[model samples]
Each structure stands twice: as structure tokens, then as C-alpha cells.
Target: MNRFKAGEHEGVTWVRGIAGWSNFSIKVFLYLVDGVLIDTGPVKLSGILVPFLEQQKIETVLLTHYHEDHSGNAPYLAGREIPVYINAISLERCRVKTRLPWYRKVFWGNREAFSPYPLDEKLTTDSLTFKPVSTPGHVFDHRSFYLPDKGFFFTGDLFVTTHPQMVLNTESTPRMIEDLKTVLRYDFSTVFCGHAGIIHRGREVLQKKLDYLEDIQGKVLHLHNRGLSVSQITRKLFPGRLHLEYLSCREWSAEHMVRSLLTGKATAENPRPRT
Candidate 1:
């Protein structure tokens, strides 16, 4: 099934997309401010997304990253001659189609290829000045946008939760910690998270996430120094696999979360049976 919801706050328009069944559904949010759209919701919900886009007077589109869930609708907007922007690192990669595993294709759907302009250091409109912030770690090409004057921060996938139990094999928890800290340095009151939706007292929420990850990092490293293997340390801290981990065929797992903190590298391994 597909789902869509629309709302507004602080003059920013947000649309949510849900793809899946009941509580198992995956969701992503698309935000629009000052005629600029941030992060296109996944392609799976394009039925609703398309009509919504048709009604908006979008002046520019800004992608927070190249992830399928975030960049899914770029092609739709680009075909209409609307200016789309992304980080330079993914500017060329997005020009070609994105390949995904079976599960990802099921959840987010496949993203079509489209050429996008590289993001400028800062973006401005008649009403607001937007600053493009380099906030990697969720993915190397990830970024966040900030509205200094309005105290609004648009965090892509950077702060999905204060404590994430499962992460993609490609993600780095340690690097993500740094990314969280990097953004916390800026003054912001409200956060527009891609998955969690609007967050007030945003700085406090981000700080908690940073603190949680840092504590996890300390625990993972302490256990590693005691001669614990990655698997051993993983079990010690984030034992067992989540349903999503099994669904993704181990592409997303607690073990990857531990490994990222220990060495910032991900290794391919089968999920150990839960004890």
C-alpha cells in the first residue's frame, strides 16, 4: 500500500510518503521552503508525489543526498525544466540509473536517472538565505541545509533516531557522530528530519543523538581493546537482528553498526543465529 500526508509549520510545507504494510511501512518526508524543495520522497509514493509537485510553484530542488528515498523524484521535476541541485560528488553518479537490492526496490522503488546542478555554498530566495552544510557519514555524499535567520535545520538522514540499532552496511556510526556534532555547532531551533518529520528543541534532540552514539562508540572500543572480535563486541552491545535486518538479507544489521564504530569499515558476513 502507499500513503501520503501533508502539513505545514514555520511556513515550511512537508509531505510524507509511506510504502509498505501497517507498522512495517518505510517512510520519507519531502520539505519545501521559500519555493525550494528539499529531498524528494521515495519513488514508491510517486503517485501522490507527482500530483503534489504539479501544484507547487517550485523554483529549485535541493537533494540532501543521492539515496533512492531522497533523490527519487528529481527526474520528475527535472523533466519539467526545474533546476535540481545535489552535492558534486553525486552530480554525475545520479545522471545514471541507481541499482538497488531486491528489498530496497520493494520499499523505496527504483530511482530514474537525471542530471542535476551542483549545490552552491549558499542559496537564497527573496525571503530566505539557505546555507548548504557538508554533513557526511550517513553516506559520504550526504549533506544538510540550514536557515540561519529562521533557525530551521533540514537534516536528511542524519538524525533518524537518537539511538539507531541497525544501519546499512555502507554507513559509519563514528563518522555519523562527527556529523551530528558538526551540525550541533550551528544555532538552530527547529529541525526537519527526512524520516522523523519536524523536531522542535532540535538542538537538544541532536545533542542526545550525539551523546548516545558517542557512548556506544566508547563501549564498542572498550570491548574491542579487551580482545573481543567484531562479532563478540556486537553481541555484547547490540545483540540480535531486527526484522528489517533479516528482510534486507543482512544489508542492514546491528553488527554493521558495531563494526562501523570499531574500524569505520564494513565486512560481509552472515548474520549469526540469535542465542
Candidate 2:
């Protein structure tokens, strides 16, 4: 079943992809503003999106990252001769057609190989100009688009939830905190999150996310100094997160958070997971 919804906001059209059967199922959003389409939704939902794009005059496509859910339709758009802009690293990754995990393949589908044009620091349209901000931590090549004039921040996967129960094996909690802080310095009142939709109070939401990660990091460091193992600290910090760990097949767990805090490195034993 194809499930999706479109909403208009001050000339920006947001297309949201419904991932699963639940009403509150995780979703991915693609935004179109000023003839510029930001982030293409997953390939699985292209049946609806392709026609939707045909109705609009999209001059260019800008990707927040090369994550399948975000960049799956790049090849389709590029085939139309529409210039698709993504960071160099993300472009390279996409060119290689990186293999995704089973869960990602099932939910977002595979990203068809695409050749994306390199994005410059600034992307400008007739009515709007977006400044690409390097906000890593979610992924090394992740970026957030900021429209200073409108006070809008298109945060890719950065502020998914104020209180995230799990961090991917590749995520660095500390780096995420820094990136959150880095973006906070900008003047933005609204946040267009990749999964959570629009956040009216963008700064406040980002601050809350930063505080949560910093608090967790502090606790993990304190417990580590006390000679507590990662598992022990995880149990103390997140007691009820075991269900989430089980659901994600341990790909996302408190241990990932602990490992990020202790070493700032991803868990080497586990295969790299997507955000």
C-alpha cells in the first residue's frame, strides 16, 4: 500500500512517506521550496512521488545526505536531466552503491546508483537561498540547510527526537552534541526535521536534544571512571531500552551510546548500521 501525505507551508511543500502500518510509524519527509526539491523520499514511495514531482517545476534537487531514505530517488530525478546536488563524500558513497542492512532495505528500499553533481556551500533559487551547514555526527557527510531570511533550518536526521532511545552503531553522541550546538549559533526559529516533520520551536528542540546527549555522556563517563563496564552503565542509564534493542536486533542500543561516550568510535564488532 502506498501511504503518503503532502502539506504546504509558506511556499514550501513537504511530502511525507509513511513507512509502516502503524499510525505513528516512522516517516521520512521531502521538502520542495522555491522550485528546489530538498531530499528525495525513499524509492519504495516513488510510485506516488514521481507523479507528484511531474506536477511541479523542480529546477534542482538538493540532498541532505546519501542515506537511502533521503536520496533514493536521485537517479530518477537525475535521469530527467535535473541537476541533483549532494556533498562530495555522499556522492562517492552513492556511486559505489553501498549495500544496506536488511531492515533498511525492507523499509527504505535500495537506492539506485546515481551521479549527483557536487553541492556548493550555498544553493540559491530565485526566491530563496539556502546555506549548507556541515552538521556531522549523524553521518560524516550529513548537512543541514538553513534559510536565514526565513529562519528555517532543514535538519536532515539530526533532531529526530528530543529523547532518542537508541543511537546507531555509527553515531557519535559527542559529535552530535557539537553539531547541535554549532547549528544553534545560527538564527533559526523553525526546524524541518527529516523524520519528525516541522518543529516550530527549532532552537528549543535542538537544545533539549543536546542536553539529553550531554547528560548521558556525563553519566557514562562518570560510571566508566568508577570501573563500570559498558553493559553495567547501559543498564543503569537506560533500563527499559532492552525492548528497543531487541526490536532493532541490537543494531541500536544503550551499548552504542556507551561505546560512543567511552571511545568516540563506533562499535567495531557490529556491522555499521544506518540512522
Against the true structure, whose lDDT is highest?
1
Q: Write the per-residue lDDT of candidate 2 for residues 171-207, one digit (tens) a residue.
A: 7777788899999999889999999998898899999
Full-model lDDT, candidate 1: 0.85
- Give lDDT tens digits, candidate 1, residues 1-275: 44788888989999988878435876788999989999888888899898988999899999998888998889999999999999987877788777788888878888988999998589989989889988777877788999999999999999988888988876788788888888989988999999999999899999998988889888988999999998898888877667888888998888877888877754432212121
Q: What's the C-alpha lDDT at position 39 in model 1?
A: 87
In TM-score terms, candidate 2 sits at: 0.92
Residue 69 lDDT in candidate 1: 90
Candidate 1, residue 188: the lDDT equals 89
| Candidate 2 local Cα displacement, residue 55, angstroms | 1.1
lDDT accuracy of residue 73 in candidate 2? 87
